[model samples]
Target: MATHASAEKRNRQRIKRTARNRAAKSELRTTLKKARNSVKTSAQDASTATVTAQSQLDRAASRGVIPKERASRLKARLAKSLHKATAKLAAAS
Candidate 1:
């Protein structure tokens, strides 16, 4: 659908960028899911998962696969959940 030479180049760039972005986002999703699941398993696991989630979120934002604000929100939620899980575990003993 690109008529001009520049437009054709842009279209190719877009295709390549799309593939790269999709892979980045998919990796972020997988990491986040693992983090959340770990929270339900144990306090140590939750702490590890939260740290991993924050790292992935920062990477996603840095790479432009996700917005900074969105990444911050996810990091906050993960931290909150981790705190709650840790507290619950502590209270149990």
Candidate 2:
């Protein structure tokens, strides 16, 4: 429990920020999962999902819910997977 007035206010802010960050992180995870799964399917779907995931990652990073470097790494990985999926599809057809 926070005893001083300033401490209580800080605790309140911490609680609010934690909840907001948690929700953003959860959404980011869900988006990433969708993007990864889509990459296993067709190229068109994978590309769209990857774009969406990248957008979400950028938004999370800008809001400080996630680190910028982590977001960049994830975006790169998503792009790489998308490229691989497209290449495999092209070879098959």
Please count the clashing residue pairs in each candidate, in the order shown.
0, 0
TM-score of model 1 (CA atoms)? 0.95
Tell me the TM-score of model 2.
0.97
Candidate that would win on lDDT: 2
Question: What does candidate 1's lDDT look like per residue over 1-93, in tens digits?
Answer: 889999999999999999999999898899899999999887787777789889989988998899999999999999999889889988998
Q: What is candidate 2's CA lDDT for residue 67?
A: 96
- The alpha-carbon lDDT assigned to residue 38 of candidate 2 equals 89
Best prediction by TM-score: 2
Question: Each model's C-alpha lDDT?
Answer: 0.91, 0.94
> What is the Cα root-mean-square deviation between model 1 and the actual structure?
0.8
Clashing pairs for predicted structure model 2, backbone only: none
Clashes of 2: 0
